[model samples]
Target: MTQAQSFSSTIFRRKPVVGARAPGQAADEPHLKRSIGTFQLTFFGVGATVGTGIFIVIPEAISMSGPAVILSFLIAGIAAGLAAICYAEMASAVPVSGSSYSYAYATMGEVVAVGIGACLMLEYGVSAAATSIGWGQYLNELINNLFGWSIPNELTAAPWGVDDPGWINLPSVILVVMCGLLLIRGASESALVNTIMVSIKIGVLLLFAAVCFTAFTSSHFSPFMPEGMAGVTSAAAVIFFTFIGLDAVSTAGDEVRNPQKAMPRAIVGALIVVVSIYLLTAVASIGAQAWTEFSPDDEASLSRLANSVTGSTWVGDIIALGAVISIFSVTLVVIYGQTRILFAMGRDGLLPKTFAQVSPKTMVPVNNTVIVCGVIALLGGFVPIDALWDLVSVGTLAAFITVSIGVVILRRTMPDLPRPFKVPGYPVTPVLSVAACVWILSGLAPVTFLFFGLWVAAALLFYFLWGRRHSKLNTGPASSADEVSQ
Candidate 1:
């Protein structure tokens, strides 16, 4: 057979292409300012990780595990941290912006890359929608506390909301649109903004914990494991959504100044800070009231907790206001991450090229941002918040497990490649990362897995029908191939 025929036959083949520069990145292109240090990157991780789930997830988790939800938090954190360590190695090796999608493409086959991209869509896109929904609830709380007026139920709630079914969630849709506009305008979360957001998030949680602790009673701790080990694992699976953004630290690997030393520090630091805050807040909240009082249907549970603990509405108002501000930023960040991931896929020809188009005026993917926000707004405006959180957890867990496996695959395939940061326990760490994620996956409701499987299958179908024929690999030089096998 001719060389051209040989190359064409290998188009769908697996290739190990770590550290390859992404399409559109030019040799002469100006370098991104190497301004992010460990402290700043740590803040980015914390800022992205905290707000989305804590404001709304607490009640859901509590309902599952009672006072033992604290143990769930710890389990989720350890799993997240281990996956993050593996992610650091992948990021340092690949040094690109697509997060797990990019990592999988470099080490695994094109089909797997497309599958992981679908998982990321759920993680970032749906999480943004879920957080926006939570933000609307807090916005209503803040408005009512200050002005004695609330957004009408029809405008503030989704069709399937717990207390009141509404035609649409206008506030959540508005929040998503606002964030979309900012992204189109080239507004990004700089290091300073990240620090400020982190501070606001931590400050509000601390205030809630301190006030709730004042009303703590030992009797609330009885029968801590009310539902036993099953409940604890299930709660951990649900709460795992809170740690989804920890890998944002790895995605910025290329832009950091001294990634080898700084990446590990920032990831570990963010994990510790987030875990500590979650545990403290959980303990304070459960101590202040019986676990049975926690309700998954309550949209503004933290604010209500503050009010109940202090016997005043003003304290709850403070918590609500903080959630409004901080969750707005979280929505923006998650939306930004989603657009970039799609942008990466477009560049690789896994999707239409429209997604890769960069606006001359803004130098960002404007079309991609619009498409992402439109879908997110639809979900936020119509779907109930409770249903979206578990989907986010499932997608994130699958993506993290893929990253861990990618780490082990790259180690065996390219043993001599330069690595800026390595997983501490090497094979053991990656293995455990996979195990933890699998354990959490096992605890998710069967319905969640069914939905996830359908989504992944759809992505693979698109790949076979369209992506393989259009792939950049078919057109690039044979020498450009990263790896090839007969």
Candidate 2:
């Protein structure tokens, strides 16, 4: 039979719900193969979650909640882990690869799937921009420490930063654009590389922890609840943003040897590690100085602590250098996540197929990735980090809440579906997850909530007007939407 005839034949033949495979003619996913193992997955989670928020976000969190910011980390981790568990089941059941976009497509209607895709674009795209700006601060610090050379703060700060006044962050935009090029050129990160990067990040944090411990004193904890209940709640919301990447642990549903066992184990394991590290770092920082003293302008705040401890600039330099490496990986991971969400939408025919079409030349979605990179670069260059963080938090919380609810929806709709690892305590666990996310979301600034509302409205509007009519799933897919047991 000719290729077209074969394609037609394959289209009508559907696989069972379990072990469903991608259509042979749907186009190869990419040139880069799945090389990540469980350990790698764990590291990707740690690497992506460890540095950006902990080192830099603390300044804002400290200012918001005083020393009680540690509680926020715990709260955020619990909610994120719950979401990840829900995601793992859905991902395993669907047997298709993508994040919320893919899961929403198979289980929810095409319209919601597209809306989720839009949400994802915000989550990843702005996140990439956010991570880059955070990266830029450390870059400037590193330069200053190494050679006493630094870019003028004007070039680095967005014109509208809460504290720093600037029109745009030129360096941040440049960094995102560079990462886009790397990804477009088919540059992929390996699990081993991510694991090593995670190690470097953890080591640096440990160094910060150790150095601070040397100067630890109980006096810093005197005003532990200075910001009171409201401050703790508000700080939790901001701090919750840093813990968003903890779900990276569950994205590898297929490659994991024993997904049901591996998925939950890894999720819990990664969460524990992340929380412990955060607690250690927070305690160390708080021990070393007053909780109210953290500077919003200090991007390399943890490294600065090390500097103050040793009275030598070398420790800060080391921290900055490690941040540069680790955050580079973060940019890669965040950008990668953003593109994948769009790609899933494109493949589902909700957005332009071009967005999902993998380029034969690069064996990746070159056009789509490039477009995403361009948009993020613009934001990075123009948007301030503080402005970016709230938006990210809203997107994440909304997505997490949806996933938590999705767990209940899927359980009720497909009760018999094999879930590699069913979330323990089912209805209760999912409910708790949703509540936690909403509580955190409640802490968002009014402007951020308004911005989030506008974005979501745009997505739902697009879905109602356009995405619903173009869903690929309407015709039937080559594989099962939800299939595996976990």
Candidate 3:
């Protein structure tokens, strides 16, 4: 066997493949089922990409860059689109499920894979928490608008979030727990559900745009570049969080009917759709009110803009309802991603074997899903939205940079390997993609950087203490299970 093939199989501890296993194994496929298609995958991308940020993060983006946040979205979209192309190459070349962790393992090395996993936790885990926190706010908006009463702060904030000073956020925790239950029960967000949620998310924002446009005044753009280039780019960094879900497009690699044709189109297509929606919304919101009014604590902020423009509570109520539903779905999709990554790690022997185990009856990674749910629940229950945002941005940007860099490394090592779509401008495209992501990453708050440093350090420590010693590679390709118990 070729060295890369031998190396990949051995390190992942999988049975030697005499032939390529089909996309999704049918029978003995252990939590593996060919139940998706290009449409559904695209729907997954759209659904996961829509919520949280567009609803709430918009206010912050406005507060930072004013109407120039429109410029920020344009810049961030180019960067996200560029990095996604790199990710597509890695996903296709590596042929694995755990996103960057899998790509790093197959192409980079064991140590890189473990470290990337740390970043994935930030990308998916912290993102799930951040998204859930948004869900709580929207839910309260819906409840208050519909019933004229909202849940008490103590019940909604985590036991840990600044209770007057509690450390945790309660509503977010409850949402996470509910998602965990659904996942454990083998429920998944099907294509229809994803599409419906995406529609709701986009619809709400579009609704805001339609209503707020009535108040449109060209004067809103008077001080267009008021923040200067530095502030615009910095706002781009904060606004960049909304773009993190674009990577969801890459993860659907295996299921597309014709990945080569379908992938490039879907990713670029999705990027265009998202960037347009964001730009339009920013313009509308800015027209309705000055950027300074976008307080971080403003509950149901966008919906409030709707009410402001229409002079009726109905518009805001509808926006709040849409935000609540869409954010909940986004949380579920992100959490599902986290469990699958852990499952891949377990299968590779990097994590405990129990993680990869699937309940035969349910055909889901019950234990792994449960563990992830519990951890995320704790974070959501206590951590505020502001704290989770930077960690998510930093983690995702780091991983994107790795993917962009990986494209260069893979091209050098496996020139002959078939690639459906070559990143348009190989060396330049990848290099630019990396630079753009770094610029945004540079603007992260100091505390976020410190936390990210600690997270990466912890991953490295675990790799040396356990991951490296127990890696499937050390024992050899699918070596008898006997040698696996480090």
Candidate 4:
């Protein structure tokens, strides 16, 4: 091969399911411990996803689609559900840490892997930051209701968030740090804590739903689809990040026990729970309060709605408390997913090796966790939450599209590959998954498209300059076209 052809081949080289890691690496070479089960895995998805968007997305969705925001929820849920099915198949077949990045690497090539990795990083990292920002708001609300005091706006606000700008978001910074500490201890501990948080939050949301329903009026939902299909889809795009955690389950492929069975179950289970709760809450909130009354400025909108419906501060306090607990779990899980993605990249030599180093004592990527926390803290503290949400949805939806495409590619390229969980409809399912995600993508703002394009460009540039030269597949012995499993 000519020099140019050799370079092209190196860039496009695919990792095999087997021997994709450093050649001769032992089966027990200390990857993340496989301790997470189907149950905890489901909570990881619910925990990471629910708190981030549900607490805030209702008003945002309502602001766009009016009472028809309920339909927007369904649309986003369907798209997310479809993509999650594809993710299950990929996670089962690849059974790796990087989520779609790992899937793309094994099925597509090194370049696509880098691109997908960038998208996943954006999804998890930015969502963590954004969710943490909201955590600060709920913390203040809880404190205010319980003790007649709250964090000062100056300390609680992000400098960049024009909606309620402040010098720094102290509560958000603290939340990010606290979650990072929990993650450093180990995944099992983190998962246990997250599951508890998920339970509490779900119960709180249900309570809110029941309370709001007491004041339900059929008149509120009369002009459903007020924004038409365009409005519903646009709202769906805005709130799509609420469903982002479903893929967090796939990112745990390396740490999951009985991954082939656990992954698909966890993803589907989490999806059902998340979607049901969101729809219920949306219906109740809209039924009790006119959709026109939802203000984007209300931080604890659900809690306020409860307080208004019941005419008591105590109920709102409880909801705020739940938000505090649940958003913390969201931060914890998202940071965990982000670190694992970096760990996968590090293992591939696409990043500095320190990121891949699992601490001997904890059996987790301590260095990777710390780096993720620091970056997330900075973003959460300084960036406006408003700026982060759509960006997260854009990255997540893009990654979802990649996973759907990867399913089709893998099925054709490796038809007999062991897939413990096949997407039920085969070609139709994956194709629909891609189309659904694309439809959601169409609703994103032009500025979001520009920013995402720039982010992808930067990621590709880094790959050529640094990751390309250091990638393990470029230096390791050739891989066998065989399967590896957790």
Candidate 5:
């Protein structure tokens, strides 16, 4: 092949989808064991999702859209639902651990897959760090409420995140390490813990809804669209990060039982549960308190709202406790997703081989998980949460758009491919998903776009320098699991 043709082939090369096992499998070949079922998989979605977003985003959204944040929730839900539908098709068809990165690889090309992997890193790894910061704050609040004393600011706050910077966020580092150890134990144990946390999360939110509704008066919702559709759209963009858990569910495709069936179900089920809870909580919050009272800086907004409704501090204490647990689960699942994405990149020869090596005893990516957690712990301990959070919504929306487009591309390019679950209303659905994400993207701050642009550029630069030459697709056709050998 000419140099031009070879270069073209390198960038556009795609991977073929095959069965789960590595080709020429030996009795001792390492692979991610399939232990997750539909039930645990659904909790993975809920646990990763129902975290600091609901506790924090409600107030943030209300500040942006007034009581019309209700409309914002609906708009964001529709957009997320459309994306989830497209994701379901991709996850079911690809059935891999890399989420949208694998889908883009199979449909778009290796270069696009690298870009998608960059986006996933932002969505999972950075968000894990951000969530850890939130968890530390909530843990402090819970402790103060229960014992009338809290961790010193030097131990709980980041070095540069606020007016009062501290030496380090020790709790944030602790949280990340705790989640990493759980992941190293194995996927099933992590899933069970996540399920329990999700249940508590749901219960706490329901409790908030039940109590808030009792004090609910129709007066607060009057002039619902006060700031109009512009406000709703902007708020939707702000809160869109909450919906990313639906996509997180797909990252476990390699470890899920009957992935063709469970993958789609888990994605759809998680979307429904997350959207419903968000809507219910949004409505209750607006009804219980005039939207004007919400402050953007309130870290314990939900708990504060509960306090006003009950005229006591006990309910707020419980809400803070729940927030602590919820953020832990979020940090855990986001770290899990990040490790798996790196594992996939490693398996494709895009990253170091150590990332792809599954531990023989635990059937998990122990080294990869440790590396991911270590990086996240450093970020959480030293970096400002504000600097880390804006990128998450931008990254997540970009990845969702990729998945929607990939569904269309795969359908056209690989018409004969087996798809256990096909996207409903194919052409229109994917098109709408793309449009919705783009509209939300437009509403993000200019700083966020700048950050995103720089991140993507860095990712492509790495690909050209190293990944393009070393990619497995360049070597030859190999099964997806071929690179996982010990």
Candidate 6:
């Protein structure tokens, strides 16, 4: 065989260098602006993290552990915080756009990157769908409060919803499409919009907490651990979905100003704020109503709690309006994260070129955004919210474990590489992160694990059949102009 043929056969091998850019692309893409700061990045984390689960996951979590769900929040928060720290180290060290997918590729190998990319797609894409479903619920609540009527149940609910079965979820599809349109415009505008949404979301949650406390009764604390330690850990696994977007901060590593100082602070700050608010809300909610009264089928449980506590529909209307706005922002951010991950994979030759194409007019990957919106909208329109949540949690937990392990591997392989933020406890920190993730993974339902296994296997099969043969590294080194940017 000739030399060229021999070189082609080595496609299965890993791409060793970090931050490898595509051939002919400039060091800085002309379209994507690097204008995000610490404040903007923190909001990205907060905006993405809070709305996805809190708006919808509360009743589901309450059903799982009763009043002990507060402890579950703390457990999930710590696990997420540790994983985010490890994520910061990888972000600062690699300085890439793919989030965990890029970090896995640069440090682990091509195969691992492909696997993690699959998990991230599920994490962000399904998260977008789930949040949109939640948004639809809040929109219904808002309309009912303001106009004394809502869209017909047949048009607003998925088929699996017990109370109402619909042919399609119209509102969720519309919301996802709206977010996609905004994303196609550009990233800078999205960041500004997200900051505003974050403020509104935080303000409303605080208002709800304050009002709910007026109805607080100490008797609500009697049976805190209804299901015991087992229930607390299980609820933590379920609530883990809320923290999935904390890593969105790290995904902006290449876009942030002064990443070394900014990244860790933004991540930690977001975690603290998110966890504190969640705990306060959980306490106030159970205090306002009996834990047994939290109906798992109610998507707008928080608003309902507010209505019950204040004996009027006015407060519930305010909470619902805030949820509708903030959940829209959360959907936008997660969809943005999904598009970027696919774009990075395309650049490296793991997927189709259309994903990597950045439109000259907008400086964003318009094609990728559109594709993500199409898929996510379909899921949100047809799939039940409960069906989507566990899948998101499973994918996110697996991806977090991969990131924690990657940190340990990079430390051993490239000890001298400069990391803007290091995991504080060294090997122990990453190890504990991995352990926590595994424990959470164990708590997931067997059906969830089975579905996750099938999804991952399909992803690996695709890589072996197509990705290995078409990789950019198989061709040759990237052009000097497009060499990996530091």
lDDT of each candidate versus the true structure: 0.80, 0.70, 0.72, 0.85, 0.85, 0.81
CA RMSD (A), model 5: 3.0
Measured against the true structure, the TM-scores of the candidates, in listed sequence, are 0.92, 0.88, 0.89, 0.96, 0.95, 0.93
Instruction: Flag the better candidate by TM-score, 3 or 6.
Output: 6
Candidate 6, run of 10 with poorest lDDT: 477-486
List the candidate 3 regions with Cα displacement exceeding 4 Å: 1-31, 159-168, 185-191, 252-265, 477-486
Better of 3 and 5 by TM-score: 5
Instruction: List the candidate numbers ranked by TM-score, top first.
Output: 4, 5, 6, 1, 3, 2
Tens-digit lDDT string for candidate 6 (1-486): 888865433532444443323222346632245677889888888988888667788888888888999989988988998898888777667665778887777656677789999999988988899899889989998998899899988888888776568988999999999999998888888889999999999999999999999999878877988878888888898889778778777666656677667877788888888988889889988898888888778768888889988999999999998899889888988898888888878878889888778888877889999999999999999988878888888888888898899888778767777776788889899889989988887878899988888998999899889987787766765222122234
Could you give candidate 1's per-residue lDDT for residues 117-191 as a string of tens digits?
999988888899999998998999889988999999999778887767898999999999988887776533455
User: In candidate 3, what are the lDDT values of residues 1-486, reduced to their tens digit?
Assistant: 999986555444422211112222223544444345555565566666677668878777777777788888888888888888887766555544576766665556666777888898778898898888888788887888889998787766655554253445677888888778777765334445666777777877788898888898878887887778887887788777666666665554433455555655666666777778877888888888877778767777988888888888999999988888788778877887788778767766678888878877666778987899888887787676677887888888888888888789768766766666678778999999999998888777788889889999998888777776676556544332222110
Per-prediction count of colliding residue pairs?
A: 0, 15, 20, 0, 0, 0
Candidate with more favorable, higher lDDT: 4 or 5: 4
Q: Give the winner by TM-score: 1 or 4.
A: 4
Local accuracy of candidate 2 as per-residue lDDT tens digits, 253-347: 43345554555556566777888988898888988988867977667887787898889999889888888877876777677666656665666
Worst 10 residues of 4 by lDDT: 477-486
Error of 3 at 251 (Å): 3.9
TM-score of 5: 0.95
Instruction: Give the candidate order by descending lDDT.
Output: 4, 5, 6, 1, 3, 2
User: In lDDT terms, which candidate is top?
Assistant: 4
Model 1: ten consecutive residues of lowest lDDT: 477-486
Q: Tell me the lDDT of model 2 at 423.
A: 80
Q: By the TM-score metric, which is better: model 2 or model 3?
A: 3
Best model number under TM-score: 4
Question: What is the C-alpha lDDT profile of model 4 across 406-458, one tens digit per residue?
Answer: 88888877788788899998899989988999999999989998988899899
